[model samples]
Target: MNPLHRVGLATARHPWRTIAAWILVLVALGGLAATLGGELRDNWNVPDTRAQHGVDQLREHFPDAGGSSAQVVLHDDARLDAAVVDEVVAELEGSEHVTTVTPRLSEDGDTALLYVRYDVPTTDTDIYGIVDPLWEAAEPAEEAGYQVELGGELPGTATEIEGRGELIGILVALALLVIAFGSVVAAGLPIAVAVGGLVAGSSGVMLLAGLMDVSTSAPTIATMVGLGVGIDYALLIVTRHVARLRAGDTPVEAAARATATAGRSVVGAGLTVLVSLMGLRLAGLPTYDAFGFATAISVVCVMAAALTLVPALCALAGRRLMPRKVRRLDTSSPSGSDYSTTERGSSTTDDTWTARWVATVARKPVAWALVALTVLLALGAPALGMRTWPQDGGSDPKDSTTRAAYDLITDEFGPGANGPITLVADLDEVSPGEVEALHREVADLDEVASSTPVSTSPDGRLAVWDIEPTTSPIDEDTTVFLDELRADVLPDGVEATGYTPILGDISELLQERLWLVVGFVVLVSIVLLTVMFRSIVVPLKAAAMNLLSIAAAYGVLTLVFQHGWGSALLGVDHAIPVSSWVPILMFAVLFGLSMDYEVFLLSAVRDDWLDTGDAKGSVVRGIASTGRVISVAAAIMVAVFLGFATESAVVVKMLGVGLAVAVALDATVVRMILVPATMTLLGKWNWWLPGRSSAARQLDDELDVTPTPTH
Candidate 1:
């Protein structure tokens, strides 16, 4: 008669009504998304950073130079004819929102970069609409035997997800489900629930975009997270329901009981994920906010579907949620009304394998715990070497137009051509002589590749210079150069902003704030876990183990993406610095997800410990009950996350790999070895609370099971 049980019972009793309600909700939301959703735009504003202030100053003071610029790289083996240059300029200048097209030829005149300035910012224009026209306008140059590649705001601003990656991931998940459940119908239930939840979640994001800023990347990231959690949540509830059916409970009774237990854990796990995402907002970037909002909305919908829809569908499917093999073993099962609680965790109960494994670990708690700690620590070693920067368009696939443009420009102008820093000076505070002196000094720096003559505003309130760095945008050398410019070169009134500096500021800011995020999440999460389980040691232990899993995951990310170890297989051809935002974002997300698995396992262990005071025996039985489910659930998540690694975006690819690695290690090493061994070592002390230790032990003393249930 718990709330979860009541909702589950009501849904199961009125299965068709619940199904219809979900259908209506989906259809209405999907239609609204198709009609009212706003487009996604990149919000790279890093508050309180010099780059952000410089951008604001530029936009406010220098109207002509304020607009975002795109590049049209024209390469020719022969001398570039004036006529071809004029034609390309005229073509681009005529496009919508194009304010001007300024062409600069290389010293040899064999290559040129056309700075196509737009009247509006990149976010304000129809990006793809303008891109197609730019391509068409440059077609004449290509026809005249000039190789033209458009970069900057053209393809650089577009965020496209690879549909194939998700498709293949779902197919793989289906295969795994079938193998686990041994029935296509049973396998399909989790898939159906996940897809349904994803649709609702994605649509919700689109609708929210109409109300708030949502990045194009958010929905995809949300989809990736939703799919894994969705299937895992549904799997937990469905498995419990099937077990109830085998115990001679009717469909409604089975659904209610399953929801009472596994559904409660699903809710807890889902809420933990949502709470952790709140840390992203503390990051102080709309990009991070969009990510948090989209993913949080997604998790809510999926959790709701798992709690309500899973029960409704179970009732509709009746005994079909179980495999044919499972049904064959359930003789004289209740048809529609009987209720039974033959055994807790009968749903995920595995064979002698899990029991034996638990026994083996419990027998040598110290050794097993030490071995797991060592493995996690070893895997986490590489994280110490991880370096982060915002992944530039240079990291795109070679076939991409942005990459092509980047290469052509770099080859012609120098590495600095791809990473120009803008110098913004307040004319009201600085005289013309001072401005010229500043430009001259900056141009004379060894790291400065080239500096354009200072462009002063017509009203004489601002002066700007386009200064190119000798190194690439993500280069460590460029970071030092920027630091030197800010600390040693630039005067008080002058500030820096542009492709290189903005990304540099973002990297610097995110890295500085990373500790703040980590501290906030860890502290808050420990409190939540303690409140949820009512044990100080349990939450603290879970936190420590979660850190080990996350650290190990970071190490894998550093090796694969940063060190280029097997990065090519993940589809990123060369080693690139980790994305500036990846570590903070990864910590926030994975910490929550790691805690999710912890809750799944610990919830069961706690429930069993409460029922039986025998700590070691509870650990053994808990593993036997939940080990198979946790392993299978982790397998499903690994497959899903790995699927997203095939995405074209470097950030998405890195996230996919990192999430997959963390879940894999969390389920196997942390859950299997560490949790059981540590819990056994702690024994009755594991349940000790500030004021309830004596009472908890007195409530029950005939206890001995201790493996946490991983529903």
Candidate 2:
């Protein structure tokens, strides 16, 4: 027996022991994670870039300059501004986390901005704890008829937007399952397996956090992947087990067969997803690596549960796992044979909608292929115009303090002041004349709105200059200014560091390594598909189709988010560049998900082809048999991903909408329309091999004969 079947049989024979062991593991891991897990934080490093070099220098030589800063905005009548701002400053100075607070007044004297510097980075979890004092201090200003808003990374990090997305997604998946299976037990089994796996998987990530630097977003992304794939994997096994029981196998036998058959597909789909996620390591970014590894853990947990826990449930539940009507349909067939085989034998123009659809496609395969290809190409065209950058305070929720502060800064100061590039210079190696000349050169740049005079460090070895741009932090013009500073304007000893330059470097690095990562993921997928489908053409077609689906998703993101085509519908009122990491991460995820459907559909087709030598018949039969399950799985995944679109973070929203669109497109357009039509065109050639068929070689060797085979 194969490994998958072996696992199922072992679990079936000792269901209680298996169930107990999983439960014990979940409890132990949960306890360990809660007690010992390390804190998760955001990674802002763009390695080997000028910004990074500057950061390193600042940390080593000028540690105070590297500390995080926040803005406290107090708007009141002209008379109270100066006094109230001073009082607030005094109130903030008492906190140990507060290093300095400096106040600046607007020209009209109606506003006061207190620049609060902290000894730690804004992402430090401890900073969040200290923010409560700042808020309490601002309360007196609010009572004094002044509007006080705390803005910047620290305040934004503290804005806790409660997420009901997973709960809603689970509810939706549960409803769909009920409708599809027509039995509560069958529908609930997948959910049970999914939840158990998610709990364990999430705990595993928490434990992983203790060992490495994991992103705060890692848990959410892992949950999204875990629930979507876990439920789907369980659904596949459950669906097959139900069908087997209906075909007259006892519960133990049916569960074993389901585990051996559909169980193999689950392993294939899960491994593809795991491999695809693992490819994120090649991106050379910590955020991707953290999320990737965490998500892979979830997929592994769910897949194991589907193989072991799910089968154990089936064996314990017996025939009652299926609804009365479904059992009737299975046993009452005229030939008393399984519906799976009976449906295959039915006419091409049968009552089943999938079979009828396949018949229509078979009649005009080329035309259908053309139509599907054109639609995907058209939808994907907008990706050509996509621009990637990091999101700024402007993309924060409108009601957030960070957004309010961002607006105030943009109004009182130039937009560039919101993200001024910091220029660091080693004065020991430079002369006063060079510093003067550097200021002049920066001031002359077209994108620069203003440049601060150089201030020497206490040791007189380092000097710093703040250059504000004419555009917002994430603006394309900001990148232009950064490029000019790095390539044309900066002196040999000077380096630029700030949000604009840092994000610019990250964008450049992502673009440079994009193809390398894409090639690696595609190559791995090709190998995996070739092994699973046992055909070279199958892998090539599957790869092309998955890429097409991912392209379509990228186009949707570009059109909706980048161009603001339907931003208001999604609650985003302004157009923004897509986040630099979204596309790379989306491609990895979408490619894996698309492969999921490919594995399910193609595996069924291969099985049918092996059963009957008629290629055309197998194509229609396989699609018809697996089509409904594929649709249901895709729908579940779409619903789960779309639920996350409600997230406040722009990057999360991008992932949610993109994944949803890709799954929807892959299921309908790629799987249903393009797959059958293209296979029909290829005919028997779909199974062709370069060398002699393995079966033919084995037969010749067994007969102890060497006969030349002719094509």
Candidate 1 residue runs with Cα over 4 Å from true position: 34-37, 128-130, 329-349, 696-711
Candidate 2 has a TM-score of 0.94
Q: For candidate 1, give the lDDT.
A: 0.83
Predicted candidate 2 versus true structure: per-residue lDDT over 1-711, tens digit per residue: 556667887887778898999999999988999999778876767677888888777766764667677778887655455667778889887766788887767777777778777777666777752467778877768878987877765675665535766887899999999988788888888999999999899898988888887888888888888999999999998887776665566677667778888887888899889888988888878888898999999999999899999999988887778776855664534323554554344422232798878878988999999999999999999999999997888887787777888887788766886777888888877787898888888888788888878887777778888888999987887787678668877778899986677778888888777787789989999888876665788888999999998999999999999999997777787999998888888888878888888888887787766656578878888888887778888899999998988888778889999999999999999987899999999998887656868787345335521110000
Instruction: List residue ranges in candidate 2 displaced over 4 A.
Output: 77-80, 128-130, 159-161, 327-351, 444-446, 693-711
Error of 1 at 439 (Å): 1.5
**Which one is best on lDDT?**
1
Query: Highest TM-score: which candidate?
Result: 1
Distance (Å) between predicted and true CA of 475, model 2?
Answer: 1.7
> Global lDDT of each model?
0.83, 0.81
* Worst 10 contiguous positions by lDDT, candidate 1: 702-711
Q: Model 1, residue 251: what's the lDDT?
A: 82
**87 Cα displacement, candidate 2 (Å):** 1.9
